[model samples]
Target: MRWTALYARSRHLTVALAAVLLCAAVLPLLLGDSWSTVFATVTLGAAVAVAGVGLSGQDLDLDRTASFRWPPRRLTHLLVIGVVAGGVMLAAQGLADLPIDSSWILRDVAGLLGLTGLAATLFGGQFGWTLPMGWAMTAALVPKAVGQAYDVVAWPMATADSAQAWWVAGLLFVAGTAAYTMAGAHR
Candidate 1:
C-alpha cells in the first residue's frame, strides 16, 4: 500500500512537470519579444526539469524490469529528446526579434547543455554515466548564462557581442561533446 501511494505521487509529479514544459515552450508565441527571451529561457529550464523527471521515471521503471531491461534504449531515448527539444527551442528563439548575436547563441547553447545533462542524469543514473555529464554540461553553461544575465540586467547595459559569444559557445560545444563522449564510453 505504501509503495503504491509513492508510485501515484511520482506519476502526478511527472504530469505536473510536463505541463510546466509545455507552458515554457508556448510562452514566446503568446507574448511579444519584450518577454520572449526570458520566456524561452524559463521554458528551456523547465525542459531540463522535465527531462530530469523523465530520467527518474525511467530509472524506476528499469528497477522493476531488472529481470531483463537494457539500459541502451533509455540512453538513446534521452539523446533523441535532447536533440528534438534543443532544435525546437532554437528555432523558436530564432524566430523572435531578440539579439541574434554570439552571446545570445552562447546562452542558448549553455541552456541546451544544461537540459541535456539533466536528461542524462534522470535516465542514465543506473549506469553511472550521467553524473559527470550533467556536472560538465552544467559547468559549461554557467559562464555564458552569467554573461548574458549581466548584459541584460546590470547598469551600463552592454550590447550583445555575437563574435566573441559564438567563440565561447563553440568551445562549450566541443567541451560538451567530449563530456558526452566520456559519459557514454562504457555504453
Candidate 2:
C-alpha cells in the first residue's frame, strides 16, 4: 500500500518499543515519588529520542529524486515526530506513575525530539541517537559531566535546577531545527 511505505521507513515503532521495554525494565525501581518527577521525564525523553532518530534526514537525495517522499522537509518531519513523541509520552503518563505536571512531559518531548533531530542532522540518522542519548545517560549517571558552565545541557536539570529544563529543551529544539533544516544536501 502507499501508506505502508510511509509507515515502514519511519522509526516511530522502534522508538516506542524501546521506550516501553525500558520502562518495563526500569519502572519498578523508578516507582513512587522518584519515578513520578523529573527523573522519570529525563529517562523517557532519551528513550523516545532513540526511536525518533530514524526519521531524521533519511535518504534525502533519494527522496528529492523520488516520485514520493517520507516527509516534505527535514524541519516538518522533526516537528511532526517531535510532537507525536511528546503526545505519546504524555499519554503514557496516564497509564503509569509519572509526574503530575504536564511541563515535565513537554520538557522531555522537546529535549529528546530536538536532540535527536540535531544528532541525526549532524551524524546521520543511522547513528543520530548517539549524542543526545549518550549525553542524557552521562548526565543521569555522572552529574559532573555536563557542568554548570552549560545548564542548557538539560539532563542535569533533572536533579540540578529543574527550573531551567524548559530553557534547555527550547535551546535543543531551536538548534536542532537549524541543523536539520539547514543541513548539507549531500544525502
Candidate 3:
C-alpha cells in the first residue's frame, strides 16, 4: 500500500471526509429557500468540526517518533480540510441555486478550520470539534448587534463584506495554522 494511503488510514481521514461531505451536501438542501448566512456558517462549522477529528492520530507518541517532518504534513492536513469543506459547500449551493455568497463560505471555512486546529492544539485532537461548534452556535444565537465588538464576537455569521469579520477570520487562520503546524495536537 502507498504511504499516503497508510497515513490516511491511520488518521481516519476517510470517515472524516465522508462526514464532511455529508454535512456540506445535506444541510443547504434541508434549509431550502430559507438558507442564509447563519445556516451557511453552521453548515461550514459542522463540516469542519467533523473533518477536524483526524487532526491527530490515535497514538501521539508514535506519531511524534515518525522519521519524516511533521510541520508540512500538519499544515497540508488543515488546508485540505478547509478546501474540501469549502469546495463541497460551494458546489452544493451552486447546484441548489442557494443565495449563500462564495466569499462567506470561504471566510467561514478558513476560520472554522482554524478554530478546529486551535482546539486540537489546546485540547487534543479528539476534542477539536468543540471550539468550532461552540463558536458557531454562539454566533447563531447572539442578536445581531451593530459595531466592531459584535462583528468580532459573531464573525462566523457576519456579512461577507464585513471588515471586522475578515480580520478576525484571517487572524484566526494564521494563528491557528502557525500554532498547529509548529506544535502538533497536544499530547
Candidate 4:
C-alpha cells in the first residue's frame, strides 16, 4: 500500500489523472451537440499529452538504481494511461449524449498511447507528449480524403471502420509497447 502510494507520487500520477479528467470533461461541454471527428481526436490528444508526463521519473539515474525489475512496471504504466484516458473520454461523451463510438475512441487512445510510449523511449519521458500531439496536429491539419495512404497518415482521426487505420494503430501499439517495455524511457 505504502509502496504503491510512493510510486504514484514519484510518477506524478495524481496530476496526470486530474489533467486527463479535466480535458475529458471540458471537451464534451465545449463541443455541446456538435461533435466532430477532429474535435474528438484533439480531445484524446490533449488527455494523453497531459498524462504522458509521468512516463519517466524525476531522475533516470535514480530509476536505474532501483532494485526491482522495470519492464513490467513500464508496461503497466502505459496501459493504465490508455485505459484512464479512453475511459474518461467515453464517459464524457456518454454524459454529453454524443454519438461517438467506443471502437473509435479505443483505436485513437491506443495509437496515441503508443506514440507516447515511443516518444518516451526515443526522446525521454519528458518528451513523451510530443509525438502524439504532433501527430494529432498533423491529422487535424491534413485535408480529409479517401485512400489507404491517407488513412495511415491520419490514423488518429480515421473512422472506426477504416481497415488501414486499425492496422496502423495496432502496429504502433505493439511496437511502442515492446520498445518501451524493453528499453524503458530514455535519459
Best by TM-score: 3
Candidate ordering by lDDT (highest first): 3, 4, 2, 1
- By the lDDT metric, which is better: model 1 or model 4? 4
Clashing pairs in 4: none
Task: Tell me the tens digit of each residue's lDDT in model 3 across 1-187.
Answer: 4868978998899999999988998888888989887888888899999988888899999899988899999999999999999999999988899988899899998889889999999998988899999999899988876666878999998889999999999989988888899998998
User: Residue 183 lDDT in model 4?
Assistant: 98
For every candidate in turn, the CA RMSD to the true structure comes to 8.8, 4.3, 1.1, 1.2
The 10-residue segment of model 2 with minimum total lDDT is 152-161
| RMSD score of candidate 3 (Å) | 1.1
What TM-scores do the predictions have? 0.45, 0.68, 0.96, 0.96
Could you give candidate 4's per-residue lDDT for residues 44-131 as a string of tens digits? 9989978887899888898888888999999999999999999999998888988788999999998998899999999999999998
List where candidate 4 sits over 4 angstroms from the true fold: none
Between the candidate structures 1 and 3, which one is better when assessed by TM-score?
3
Model 1, residue 15: distance off in Å is 4.5
Q: Can you write out model 1's per-residue Cα lDDT over 10-29, one digit (the tens) per residue?
A: 43545644554464346555
- Which pairs of residues collide in candidate 2? 15-51, 61-187
lDDT of 4 at 72: 94
Q: Pick the candidate with the highest lDDT.
A: 3
Task: List candidate 2 segments past 4 Å from native.
Answer: 1-4, 10-42, 56-60, 67-73, 144-151, 154-156, 159-163, 184-187
Give the TM-score (vs. native) of candidate 2: 0.68
